[model samples]
Target: MSVLAAIAITTGILSGVWGWVAVSLGLLSWAGFLGCTSYFASPKDGLKGLGLSIATNLSGVFWAMVIIHLSTWVGIDIVGYVVTAVVAFFMCIQAKHNILNYIPGTFIGSCATFAAAGDWQLVVPSLLLGGVFGFAMKASGVWLQETLNKPDTELCEEN
Candidate 1:
């Protein structure tokens, strides 16, 4: 199995064992983000993709909070429209530079955040852990690719 898949499966098992649904969702969302970025964006643009994923996740959470606050002042229906527009506008602006390619990943992260009831204490740690896992997964993929591509002599030679 691929390293990424193995990591995800391990994370899933551990999260399920600990009954940490939020962490599980966060990790899954991050894995999705990494996969999307890796597939859609160039390998050399990994950092850019990572930054955009982070921005999108942060914006999703921020917008969710805004919508919640506005719902109290206005109404859920109106607030929904406003929030949608705001998110769309921001996403469009970001997309202009092709940096927002991981939009699905952002939405996944947002869903994970909302699923955790927008609790900062819970969400922050979960997302951070997910990010770390995502990075490790990506790095593992890179390492595996490099190893596979190396000549047999390189593999057999002593360091």
Candidate 2:
């Protein structure tokens, strides 16, 4: 299959899955989609992309939770800005490491957590599930291409 075709089909199926998880489980599919996009938009592609997506996204969630917890304890709303800035600096500098190299992915995850109003309960599982969905989308497409486009000689040998 062509790249676009595979992407289109995978997207269609996964969107349905995401939708079901959202409405039935009362989770945030949009947040999950953000995580799914993290996979595609990582600095690297393929399995490495998936790994970076998971790593950076989870890191973002962890940092966001820390900021939330600390800001509440400090009892100062403005302090969130300072805390976020410091965390952002770390997020950027951490890109020097290969696994956490995707700064934008971290930002996306962090923003999603904030948008969900500090509800790590909702954001964490949703984002993780989305990453799994993203991997499934790519792997299934590759499987389809390999299974359907095999040579006639290969098919005959299998039979």
Candidate 3:
């Protein structure tokens, strides 16, 4: 149920942002359902996950858009795809707690927007970046988990 809701909301945000009239509302509705479920399930963690997902994904899109808008200056012809791949990879990496499971569709959806805007060069780079991002995030996740699992009073109690 929550998974389905998350999918819908993610789709809606991407579609709506790209002005896809048919899918916008539907996606938004799903997102709303996810929000409601998150609110009830584990308020702090759920909300934190939602916020992080939005920030990371949206920021990726924004950066991609900028890359597309100034492709020539960056010496990169495939700005859209490159950005998408990088963002996708990072999304997978930053999944934090299985959150990355929601990445594929969201990535394709956002990449579609950039492609529609006439930036095809970004495709390959986006894919490569996505892989790299995933690996990096996994490392970070492990570190975070280990760090968080330590007893808080151990150091504080000594010296």
Highest TM-score among the candidates is held by which one?
2
Model 1: lowest-lDDT 10 consecutive positions = 35-44
Candidate 1 stretches with Cα past 4 Å from truth are 1-45, 75-94, 97-102
Better of 2 and 3 by lDDT: 2
**Candidate models: Cα lDDT each:** 0.54, 0.84, 0.42
Candidate 2, 35-122: lDDT as tens digits:
8888877777678888899899988887888888888888888997888788889978988988888998888888889899988889
Residue-by-residue lDDT tens digits, candidate 3, 115-144: 546333333233223322333333344455
The true-versus-predicted C-alpha distance at residue 60 of model 3, in Å, is 1.1
TM-score of 2: 0.87
**Best of the candidates, lDDT:** 2
Summarize candidate 1's per-residue lDDT along 42-105 as a digit string, tens digits. 3233556556666555555565565556655676687778776786566446545555555554
Stretches of candidate 3 off by over 4 Å are 1-45, 72-112, 118-159
From the highest TM-score down, the ranking of the candidates is 2, 1, 3
CA deviation > 4 Å runs, candidate 2 = 75-78
Q: What is the TM-score of each predicted model, taking all chains together?
A: 0.59, 0.87, 0.30
The collision pairs in model 1 are none
